[model samples]
Target: MKAIVLEKAGGPENLHVAEVTKPCIKENEVLVAVKAISLNPADVKPKYEDEMLSMMYGKERPVILGWDIAGTVTEVGSAVTNFEVGDKVFGMVNFPGIGNAYAEFVAAPEAHLAVMPSNVSFTEAAATTLAALTALQILSGKINKGDKVLIQAGSGGVGHFAIQIAKNFGAYVITTASAKNKDFVLSIGADEAIDYHTQKFEEILSDIDFVLDTQGGKVLENSAKVLKNGGAIITTVAPDLPEGVKAAAEKENKTITNILVHSSAEDMNTLKRMLESGAIKPNIYKTFAFEAMADAHREVEKGRTVGKVIVTI
Candidate 1:
């Protein structure tokens, strides 16, 4: 199998293509011939930071860095009942752990995958796994119909999905993006788009029932200000709230918490249905060939991609 192996933790240049042994499947896992992979900020971080590299793979040198994958099952584990050799499957495999998805093949837990919908392409299915799952998990039980919801960084990977998911739940979705991306965000279902460069979101928006804060630091703190008293804010970026932000939340009787997206077949099925029905659509900013994984990382590191960046095998 061909894989992009990380030679060292420094930059995209460290990601080099090499021939590697194919992975073997566990009793509950399936061997998939990877067709497409999605890039996330998580994938980009480990490339430049040893700390993040150790956290994700734990001293494994020449590690394969990826999780979001869409592919066809080539072999199923003995205990895998839900999938067969020919089934098309997709998911964020072993998230917060080793996924080894930036390759021609991957060993995915059967429980982590959902059968890709017939209406969704491999690239689109791959794009939805991590980012869509994060959005679905964050807002599933937290949002209600007609509530005002704010999704920060609405043009990024997770933000784009959050906007559509919030709207599907009948929430009045508001999003923050640069002026150039304002129309793009609105087209994807955001009821209102705040130009983050010019307007302060807290000043223009108020009483937001829920907030999905993708950007941390000042953005997370500012997002708290716009929430209605007793409302909640879920941040995917900030692991811990600053003392001042915590104090403000406490004073307002609001909830502030950090979230890391995990793998879920059930949630993947929900996303599968949404994709099938066109309830939510993936806005792919670009797709790179498998050999161009390094270039793909460079594009994502720019922090300006409007939506998901994909790599096709």
Candidate 2:
């Protein structure tokens, strides 16, 4: 099997195409013939930082750096009952762990995958896995209908999905993006779009019931100012809330926490239904060939893609 392998952490250039042995499946895992892979900001971190690579894979050499995949199952584990040999599946496999998805085939746990919606393409399904899962997990059971929800960096992968998901739950969705992407965000169910380049979000917005913060530091800090007294802020970027931000949240009786996205077949099924019904559409900014994985990384690192960037296998 052909896979993109990283022997050492350095740069996108270090991600090299090489012939490698195919992975074997565990008793509860299925072998997927990967058709598409989604690239996340998290995927790029380990490629450049040695510590990140060690932290994620624990000193594994020649690591494969990807988790989100959409593909057809070629073989099923002995204990797997939900999926057959030919089922189309999509999910974020072994998130916060090794997925080894940048290859021709991947061995994914059955619990981590959902049947790909018939209406969704492989590329679109791949795009939805990690980013959409994060959005779904963050907002589920957190916001109510008609509540005001703010999603920061609305033009990015997770933000775009969060906007749609929040709106689907009947919340009044507000989001931050540059002026150029204001229309783009609005088209995807955001009730209001704040131009982050020109207007400070906290200065003009207030009484937000929930905030989905994709950008940390000052952005995360400022998000606290707009939340209502009993509202909550969920950040995907920051590991720890800044002291001042935490103090403000505590003083106002608000909630602030960081979220690490995990794999869930149930949530993936929910997303599958949404995708099938067109309640949420993945805005694919671009698609690169499997051989152009490095180019995809470069595009994601630019931090300006309006939505998810995909690599088709």
Candidate 3:
């Protein structure tokens, strides 16, 4: 089998296409002939400083990196019953150890897979898993109708979905982007768009009910000022809540929280239903052939893509 392999974590230049052994299916896993995969921040993060990945997975060499996948089930485990060999599926595999996705095949656990919606294209479905799930979990059990929500990096992959989901929950959504993306963010249901290059979001937004911070650091700290009393701020970019963020939120009588996205079959099903019903749409900024995995990672590192970037096998 041919796969993109990385012997060590460094940069995009270190990725190489090479012949490798095929993965054997486990008792609770299904082997998928991958048709498409999408790039995410998770893919790039491991390539730089992933000591935790090495410690947990004990991966020695020739590591494969990718999670978001859309493919057909070519082989199923003895314990699996919900899906058959011919079923079309889309979902995110677990990170690190199970990440054999940037190749022709991926052996994913049955619990991590979901039936692909007939109306959603393979590319779009492949792109939906991680970003949509992150947005869903962050906004779930929090946002309310008529509430004011602020989403940072609204033109990025997760931000676009967050804007739409918040809108679906009947919130008045405001988003931050450059001037070039103001209209694009608004098109995805943001009620107001703040041009980050020309205007300060803190100066324009106030009394917000929720803040989804995709861009961390100072943007997150500044966001606290605009929250109404008892409002909540959620972020995915980092684990720690900086003292400045906590102080600002405390001053405004608000809460600060950090999030790490976790994959689940149930969340993917909800995303599938939303996609099938035309309530939410995925924005695919680009697609690359499987051989161009390195280039895809490079693009993701730039952090400027308007939406997801996919790799087709």
Candidate 4:
């Protein structure tokens, strides 16, 4: 198997393509011939010096880092019941073990895998898993017909999904993006797209039922001010609840939350159904060959992508 390996935590240069041994499947795992893989912010965050030294390498176990994968199951363990050899599947991989998905093969637990929809392309399936699930979880609060919702970074991977998902549930959605992306975000279902560069989001929007804050820092802080009382502020970035959210929630008695997206097979299934029904689709910002995995990561790190960036194997 040729994999982009991170032998030691460092910069993008440390991620080099090399021939590595193929992973062996456990009794409940499926061996996938990875057709495509996608990048997320989490892929780089865990490799930060403080995080790696304190949590991962500090434990004496070097790890492979990939989470979102879409591929074909070439083999299945004896205990695997949900999938079989030659089944097309996609899902987020279990972290810290065989998340070596930037390769030709990956062995993932069957419970973590879902059948890929026939109508969607492999790259779209690969890119939608983690980011889509994050948006779904963040916006899980009450959604009623004609209700208003806000999505920050609406042209990015998670934000695009959030806007579409909120719209699917009959909510009017507002989103923030660059001036260049305003039209793009609105076409994807955002009722109004705020240009984060030219104007403040809080100044133009208010009385929201939910706010999906993909950009944190002061954006997270400013987002809270625009929500109606008791409206939720959900974030994938800012692992900690932003102090502004906490302070404002304290002052006005609102609810704010921060979540590190989880890899969920069930959510992947729902996403596939939505795609097949034409209710949602991944907006791919770009695609790279597997050999260009490092470049894909660099693009994601820039934080200006219009949608998910995929590495096709």
Best by lDDT: 1
* Residue range 142-212, candidate 4, lDDT tens digits: 56778888888889888899889999999998888898998899888888887878898778787887778
Q: Report the lDDT tens digits of candidate 1 across residue range 11-51.
A: 99888999999998999999999999999999998678888
Whose lDDT is higher: candidate 2's or candidate 4's?
2
Off by over 4 Å in 1: none
Candidate number that wins on lDDT, 2 or 3: 2
Provide the TM-score for each candidate, comma-separated. 0.98, 0.98, 0.95, 0.93
Which digits, one per residue and each the tens of the lDDT, describe model 2 over residues 144-172? 99999999999999999999999999999
For model 3, the stretches where C-alpha displacement exceeds 4 angstroms are 50-59, 239-245
Task: For each candidate in the order shown, give its overall lDDT on alpha carbons.
Answer: 0.94, 0.93, 0.87, 0.81
Worst 10 residues of 2 by lDDT: 237-246
TM-score quality measure for candidate 3: 0.95
Candidate 4 overall Cα lDDT vs. reference?
0.81
Better of 2 and 4 by TM-score: 2
